[model samples]
Target: MPSLDDQPAASDLHHAVLAWYDMHARDLPWRRPEASAWSVMVSEFMLQQTPVARVLPVHEAWLERWPTPADLAAEPTGEAVRAWGRLGYPRRALRLHAAAVAITEQHDGVVPDSYDDLIALPGVGDYTAAAIASFAYGRRHVVLDTNVRRVFARAVAGVEFPATAVTRAERDLATGLLPDEEATAATWAVAVMELGALVCTASSPRCGACPIADVCRWRLAGHPAYDGPPRKAQAWAGTDRQCRGRLMAVLRESEGPVHASALAAAWDDAVQRERCLVGLIDDALVVRVGPESYALP
Candidate 1:
């Protein structure tokens, strides 16, 4: 593990990054003070492996239709799937709906403020629990998303990219760098994330614009290319995921159950289409309404 003493002073990095965030952070609705805890939770779920620009409109519509956890929980789970639109990962929609039901039933329609309570909810993992606690409730906790991890890897560990999965060393580094004060730590967490998203991006980072560029160990050591195990790009075309998506689109478009023939027409390969349909049914993203029909569940 890299010694915490070896990294740049937390205060200096916090000041620079927080100041930059105050001036340049995107005016996202979820970040607004008026945003409810439910809003933050919704944004967290939608923003997973998805970009902000793509989430904006869908988020707005989602909140407009189902402003509270109770509202979402009251509707059919299938409705949630329908509203998910072309977000690619439809399972997230199912998970979000399940979370809403759990929150409405257990949390009194309120998103929990504590990490323990939040994590107990369906679909809320460790990172999501920490994020909801920190960002939504202004609690002191380490919020280590992919962006934050990358920022830490470069600025503290002098690495071009972090390991495929977060390491225990990385967690310790983040915990050490965290500000003691609750509110400051919350802002610092998001500030680092914003910096990573806007400046220290994965493909092409804008080092000149980065606030902590001067002290970044990666830059100080001369920016090196990632030489770890080969990173595989996500395949989309003709994959099971793509086939599932096409089948889902047909289900989402129809108000009533779609006949098996319609779903067959959506995809070319009959065997692959059948496989995707069965998988979707097993996932509960699609329900077998009839012998020859399917619908969003």
Candidate 2:
């Protein structure tokens, strides 16, 4: 078992991973030293369940428009949703706008440096708050996103995946792995995340390119196939989610309120279409301009 104090062996693993990160970290805008705390916060939001490639242009356009939290706060909340632009899960855009409003109103337009304050903001959860703290402010935190959790699963737990949900055991393991120095701990957090993204991928892990492959518990165990509970993959086609996206696209592509007939044109099934439109309104993704008119909110 890879206990907290795996000792001299773990220390070597840490050095090796960090060294690899220094040489191989991707040149993401948010990773740059000049990236503002607000920028880091924005990246974290856009990145949730979305690919880096998908996020890049949207992030660039978002930054170009709302250069500061104050700038986003100044715009109508609806503009944020419209600008969100098919990123899927448009609620994140609303949450980000709300967070920007909070930052403007309470934090003097500054993205808080501490995890506590960051977590208090809208859309900022434990992972996001920790990421902004560590990546933006160089604070020590156990930043466990999917990527980081996967790395730890393979490298320490000899597993193909972490639990479907984070357990207390997993949380403690990550906390225990933190370096004593704040900056070093922050670096380690991102390094592990990057390693999982680039090398220890969930579908096609390149073990030959991994920094800690030699000491990886899963590798040492001869790469046994996962035999735990089946994981649910996201389904899109013919689903309400896609229906909702189609409806949202109609609203997003329009500058003014769209007629109910126009919205109905986006989807085929009348029952499913109405169900999805009602769900969107319930979710506050759409606002009724009139009894038969709809627009994005």
Report how far off residue 39 is in candidate 2 (Å): 0.6
Kindly list the per-residue Cα lDDT of model 2 for residues 1-297, writing each as its tens digit: 544334326687789999999999999998887888888889999999999999999999999899999999998878999999978899999899999999999999899898899999888899999999999999999999999999889888888999999999999988888888999999999999999999999988999998888778888788889988999888989999999999999999999999999978889899999999999899888999898999987
lDDT of 1 by residue, 1-297 (tens): 233346788888989999999999999999998999999999999998889999999999999999999999999889999999988688889999999999988888889899999998877898999999999999999999999999999998888999999899999999999999999999999999999999999978999999998788888878988888988988989999999989999999998999989998899999999998899989999999888988888
lDDT, candidates in the order shown? 0.92, 0.90
- Clash count for each candidate, listed in order shown: 0, 0
How far does residue 98 in candidate 1 sit from its true spot (Å)?
A: 0.9
Candidate 2 wrong stretches, greater than 4 Å: 1-8
Which residue pairs collide in model 1, if any?
A: none
